[model samples]
Target: MKTLRAFITMVALVVVGYLAWNGYIEPEPDGDSTAKPTATAAPPVKPAKGVTVTSFRQASRLLKVIPEDRQAYLRSYFGKGWIDADKDCRDTRQEVLARDSLVPVSKGCRIYLGKWLSYYDNKTWTKSFQVQIDHLVPLAEAWDSGAYQWTKATRIRFANDLKEKRGLVPTTTSLNYDKLADDPQWYIPKVNKCKYIASWIAVKARWSMTVDQREKDAIDRVMKGCPDRKLTITRAKIGLLPFAAGTGTSNRNVTIDSIVYSGRSEKIILRNTGSSPAKLIGWVVRDEIGYGQYRMPKTVIPAGGTLTILSSEGRKRLDAAGNPVQHANWGDVWNNSGDTATLIDGKRKVADICRYTGDNSGKARC
Candidate 1:
């Protein structure tokens, strides 16, 4: 009896223990149930440097095209060995794609270059379906700058040279066509100018290109602002000409109305003070700080007028005609290439000549 009673108690305890374990213990989570995930921190963005790059634009005047007489020769020469003429872009686009792109592909006859990134405007696109093929030196500019005299073969080579075409930086098609051939003076991007100038110069130098006076002046102006040596060509869009009024004649009476200094050049406010309206030829004199003194071309200031001057720091380093802008510390007389000016007889004149002895300070009181 005692043994049976003890066994029964043991069994009861065992059953209670088993019930507690089964009822209280939690089961493992099913495969479908999941724990919440922790959130991650994002990376910080950095600020842009000093200046931002912008789109490229055409200069003021319309760029001219090569003369018709040379077209046939160029076509025949460029067209030669073009066995796949029906579908391919001859050699110009093909070579350009090969040179400018990272991965260039050939589709039987037509060549296709991969996508490109435009540093100027920060746009990206592939060179597929007639995209990305552009002119390095614009076609119109070539015509005006002596391409008119080139033989058809020469023009054709110029038009389709892989080397030249390689410079056809991928930019907005509209902006490229807008430049049409005008000098940088009339056309240029407001930002990213240094790159634009350098690139334009590289193209001009490569082709041994000649420019008109305006074009030459444009090149000079652009080069003065370039900071980098390699970032030559960039995208561009034209800006309004703030100081193109007195471009033909020099030595015109100029007023120093406004003064602006960009990292690259100086912008001054001027007016036409000549008796008859004059064309601004070019710059002649500079101030101590290297700004242009704005003069008449023939060293003649008009009878009753004023002209403003624009200058670069480079100009102040040299004389009006490419000599040193030396100070007149040698003798009793002030002898700097650029002396300050005052209005005299309705004309703004520099103090360098014999008539204006004490007028170098640029004070109206004198």
Candidate 2:
């Protein structure tokens, strides 16, 4: 009986110690659910870091002025698909449409039939189909400029960025096609040219994508008329995990528990080993070879709960709150033979990672 009681006491002491340790390190939760384990919520994303150029000339100088390799471009490398960030059936195209629409857009899971004015040509449309979401920096151009060396996660982050409308905009289909993959030297918008050039420079400088001498020279020539035009680009804001924006410690207990890849597909399990719920908004799970990449939605992982991400749609999955979130379909991301799974936090910090190679059973514990 003494031995039994001693063992029970030891177990209780260990559990208490763990909770105390986590309570000290992790953000303390306050009365509010969103509060950090300590009552402060993590701050929502802000342009706290990166270069802030007040004028167009300064913004232009921020870019790595160099010649692009201009390699044979493959559109698929950058993965030009939109994401349903709000769980609305509509992808990024519809989101942009809704944002740009002057009229009330339909609010349905699979919808967004609305009106949009394409500033590229100063034309307006009543139907969403008439407008195209134009990347201020064309994907092909971005790839050549420097994106070719980026990982799939980086590519997806660039393509599906809904944080700011500066990078992507709604435009008429004809004009979008006309400007396809052409740099400023070859093509500059006829209307709203200053705004277009400013946005273009903003995108290039924000992504830290290089500019060839010709591209830089062209921008210099175009901006001569508007030399002091103001432009602001927010870089490193892509990984914004929504928070209350006050005093609180960042939760560092969330980590990858394991990576399971079958012969055909892949899934990663993220576990939060903290005392409080871990808000994983803006976090990213990606494989090294650009096959599977998932930027987490505005979701929370209960202290002890686990969330699984499949490369493609598998079964109906539920988050910690029992809410169903539509994870993006990354077609065949893992190498199956060998790959590395990395969990990157909103601050662009690698919280945890797991590597697996030649695992016939296809499960790697981190």
Candidate 3:
């Protein structure tokens, strides 16, 4: 019994010693416990307001043209005095660099891209080869703007004359290529149309050009985000569209999502994909069966929206007056002669329905 008691006492002493050492002699937390760390997130990517070709307008304030003969005479007499070859007035390249660049460069009258940034692809390149000098008013386009009526001398003067300082702009080579020969009313950079319209206006004004109502309507769609019809194209005035809560945005608050297309055959449908309510504006349709591809507007859809598959065509569609027709939905087979409808958002297309097919026969798809 005495030995057992001694053993218990020794054990108790050991336990007490161990507890004391653990409680008082511990290592520090390396300050990690005391400090709170912050989260590092990527900066927001704000939707480029007027980031499109429209920004070019702010710098373009001149209009009217000097007669080509007078300009040539000035060039001949001055001999690089009044008119400098490729150095006279602002060429499209210099003007664009001055307008589009974040950091612009110039050597006397010539302007070069200090850094090549492609707005269409959201890409940044180091060399000028990646970029191109785009003509806001293409040569063919210049013809439409009244250049075709002019003499060759006048055309040449207009083509390269810096005095009018109307055409030529440096942009991403790809973008320029894609936009070549297309009208401003038809093709505009999806990212910043307001900018495109303004730049378009600037070129038109400089070259004494005019726009029809249809073209004006397209421009209005983009300008809707601006404070008014008369919007100033600048970096600061671009505002944000209200998206759904928790949709998540970058530092610039541009939606991380995009609206896409889906369907097969000429009789097709469109759908809204983003979390927000997209405005269904227009569409593009092509049918090999005599119905060549066409661009037209859906009467009821809004800009920047989507179109649901409310109905179809190939399957014996209906008319506007709720009537039935023998050959309603198969529009491509009967009219256009194709079997595909590729609906492009923000584009226009034509839809056909017999007056007696669906609810309303002889009624076209609005």
Over 311-337, each residue of candidate 3 has an lDDT whose tens digit, in order, gives: 224323334542221211222331222
Q: Residue by residue across 1-366, what tens digits does model 2's lDDT show?
A: 999999999999888789888885453465776764446888855555674747777788888887774543556666757877677687887777777788887786544467777877889888667878998899989888877556667777788878768888988988988989899988888888778888888888777788899888888888887748667778744321242122112358988888777655567778878777887655667788544666555567777777777666554568567634444476666655778988877665688888878766667777
TM-score of each model, paired residue for residue:
0.37, 0.51, 0.34
**Winning candidate number (TM-score):** 2
Superposed by TM-score, candidate 2 places the C-alpha of residue 355 at a distance from the truth, in angstroms, of 39
Candidate 1: deviation at residue 210, Å? Answer: 1.0
* Best candidate (score: lDDT): 2
CA lDDT of every candidate = 0.44, 0.73, 0.43
Whose lDDT is higher: candidate 1's or candidate 3's?
1
Q: Give model 2's clash tally.
A: 11
